[model samples]
Target: MIIDFFSAGFDVFSSPLALILTFTGIIVGLVVGAMPGLGPLMGIILLLPVAIGLPAVAAMGFLIAIFVGGSCGGSISAILLRIPGTPLAAATLYDGYPLAQKGRASDAIGIAITSSAIGGLIGGIVLVFALPS
Candidate 1:
């Protein structure tokens, strides 16, 4: 029962359209999220018009990807400018700024992004496996 639901949800990715949209959404999210004051929600809202024409699965995939990417994107600004792109990146600003000042801006950004990705992966796993049962 639960397994079937999970499988059905994963099945949406079988479509190439969903993959492409998701990828594009991530890029768009990264760009939008790097801008100060524009977080994941705003990125989704701004892009909703475009998503309107997409199929349901693709739209959801795109929006979800945007959210994930946006959440990580704020770290870019935090690392580069010492200013958090969003409140979610506030913690990043502390360590990220120091690294940036040390001529390791690239390294700081990489670490921030990688850590965010890993955190998201772990959170997703916990939600899917631990929380369900």
Candidate 2:
């Protein structure tokens, strides 16, 4: 059963269209999320109509990418401008602002991206393994 799940996931991700849409969604989400008053929910909602026209697997991939991108995007503004782009990024302003003041904005952004990726990976793994138990 676990193997089947992995196989299905791989198959879905192997689609070129899915990959392209996911990347585009991520870019769009990042842009939207970096703007104040916008967040992942809004980003996803805005793209919902486009997703509705896509295949199930591709749509899921695209939406998930948007969600992940948006979650991280807010930190960009928080770090660079000392303004929280989203409510979720408010906490980041503490360290992010300090880092930016020190001329380490790039470092802060890198750290944010890396941490987000790691956290997402762990979450995905946990969800996958926990689902069967």
Candidate 3:
């Protein structure tokens, strides 16, 4: 029963439509997060009406992807422009700007991306374990 439950969850996420929607959400989140005065809340709120029409699982996946992308996107501006695109990224400027000044901007961005992926994996694991069956 537990195996079946896990497999069913994986099947939903592996679907073509879910993948497409997740990608779209991530792009939208990244764009919003990279812009000054824009953030995930605004992005999600703006798209909430559209998300409402989707299936429950897809809607959750889409919104969650947006959140993940937005969280990571702020680092882009911080590293390249020395300006934190969102408040969440403000601390990133400390290291990101210094790296950019040293002509290692690519390295900074790469580290940020890698860190985000690790964090996302951890978050996913926690979510899976924490959710009530």
Candidate 4:
């Protein structure tokens, strides 16, 4: 049953428009999230009108991509500027800023992004495998 759902999702995402909108949403979210005071929620709010016009699957993919990208984007500012682009990024500023101060801004940003990706992947895996009965 879950496999069927997964297969259906793959079929839906095979659409070019869905792929394009998802990538665009990620880019837009990254830009918006990098700015201090703008988080993933803000990114979603800003792009809600655009999402509203999209088809159901495409809109969902776009919004989810935006959230994923935005979640990672905040660390860019947190590391480089010692400022949290979002509240969730506040913790990043601690170690990330120190690394940046030590002349490893790129490394810090890389680590931040990699960690965020790993965390997201683990969380996603957990969500998928641990669905409620």
Candidate 5:
């Protein structure tokens, strides 16, 4: 299965539509996430209509993409406005707002985004292995 995954991933990633869906999902996620109280669950639920009309794989990719980007994007409000955009982002305000106040908002945001991506990757890996077992 692991070997199959690497091979399949290479091919799947080469497809333009997959890339588009992923990109679109990330953008949609970031936009939706910026709204306070509209977390990944809400974003996914709101976009469920798209899933209904699309292939299951594409829909799931989009939903996960949103979850990844949305979680990261929520930090923007936490830093810039000192408001916890989502429950998960409440912790971000502690250091995020301080960095913003120090005029390092961009750096803080960059770190937050990078960290979120790493965290998401870990979560995905764990989810993948856990799903079938």
Candidate 6:
């Protein structure tokens, strides 16, 4: 039954339009994360209303997205303002804060961006395997 759900879910997700929407969402999330006042927490919090209106699987995906976007957004403040937006980014601050203080904020941000992309790639692969085609 779960497998059936996953399969049905994956089938819906496999469409070009669905993929486009997902990618658009990721880009929008990252943009939201990049802003100074719009940190990851705020971004996710703001989206909560929309999440609640979604279906079960969509709501789950949207919530999963909060973390993914947060991973990128949390590091932004650490790299730009030397403040951690999320606790998970406390580790990011160890080197990122110093890097920013030393005028290496861009480098730190670049690394954070790359790590986020790699993670997304791995997640995409896992998602592909997790759902029966």
Measured by lDDT, the strongest candidate is 1
The regions of model 6 sitting more than 4 angstroms off are 1-10, 31-45, 52-60, 120-133
Model 1, runs deviating above 4 Å: 1-3
Candidate 5 lDDT trough over 10 residues, lowest sum: 10-19
Q: TM-score per candidate, in order?
A: 0.92, 0.94, 0.88, 0.93, 0.85, 0.62
By lDDT, the better pick of 1 and 5 is: 1
- Which scores better on TM-score, 5 or 6? 5
lDDT of each: 0.90, 0.89, 0.88, 0.89, 0.83, 0.71
Between candidates 1 and 4, the TM-score winner = 4
lDDT at 124, model 3 = 77
TM-score winner among the candidates? 2
lDDT of 6 by residue, 11-103 (tens): 866766445545655665666665655656676688778777766556556656655776677778877776676665667888888898888
Question: If candidate 5 were superposed on the true structure by all CA atoms, what would the RMSD be?
Answer: 2.3
RMSD of each: 1.5, 1.2, 1.8, 1.2, 2.3, 4.7
Q: Which ten residues in a row have the lowest lDDT in candidate 2?
A: 124-133
lDDT of 2 by residue, 46-131 (tens): 89999999999899989988888898899999999988888878999999889999999999989988998899999988887788
- Rank ordering of all candidates by lDDT, starting from the highest: 1, 4, 2, 3, 5, 6
Model 3 RMSD in angstroms = 1.8
Q: Clash pairs of candidate 1?
A: none
Clashing pairs in 3: none
Error (Å) of candidate 4 at residue 34 is: 1.0
Q: In candidate 3, what are the lDDT values of residues 77-127, reduced to their tens digit?
A: 998898887888898899999999999999998998899899889987999
TM-score quality measure for candidate 4: 0.93
